[model samples]
Target: MRLGECRQLRVKDMDVERRQILARDGRGQKDRITLLPEKAVTILR
Candidate 1:
């Protein structure tokens, strides 16, 4: 995801169980799902 998308991220956009980060509005102004690292999940939590 882009910096803008990360800044706009919300709790609802996180799928911890799935280990994915949902970018509701990405680089092309489109939605995408990116991998969420285990280490990052702990930080995000």
Candidate 2:
């Protein structure tokens, strides 16, 4: 994800069960889907 979008992330943006991140206000000022890797998920938790 772009730095700006990542900065805007909220708890609601992370879907742990589905293992995905909802990247809002992205590089082009759009929302997009990004993956949440298994390793990262464990770490985040």
Candidate 3:
């Protein structure tokens, strides 16, 4: 993901059970869903 996307992430954007992240205002000003890297799970929690 881009640095901007990461910076915009909020706690509510995380779906830990599904290991997903909702990236808002992304490319073309559209929203998208992306997989959360397994390595980041623990840190995010």
Give the winner by TM-score: 3
Better by lDDT, candidate 3 or 2:
3
Candidate 2 lDDT score at position 26: 79
Candidate 2 has a TM-score of 0.83
Score residue 8 of candidate 3 by CA lDDT: 100
Clashing pairs in 3: none
lDDT of 1 by residue, 1-45 (tens): 689989999998889989998988777789999999899989877
lDDT of each: 0.88, 0.90, 0.93
Summing lDDT over every window of 10 consecutive residues in candidate 1, give the lowest-scoring window: 21-30
- What TM-score does prediction 1 earn? 0.81
Estimate TM-scores for all models.
0.81, 0.83, 0.84
lDDT for model 2 = 0.90
Ranking by TM-score: 3, 2, 1
**On residues 1-45, what C-alpha lDDT tens digit does candidate 2 reach at each position?**
788887889999999989999998776678998999999899988
In candidate 1, stretches whose alpha carbon ends up further than 4 angstroms from where it belongs are none
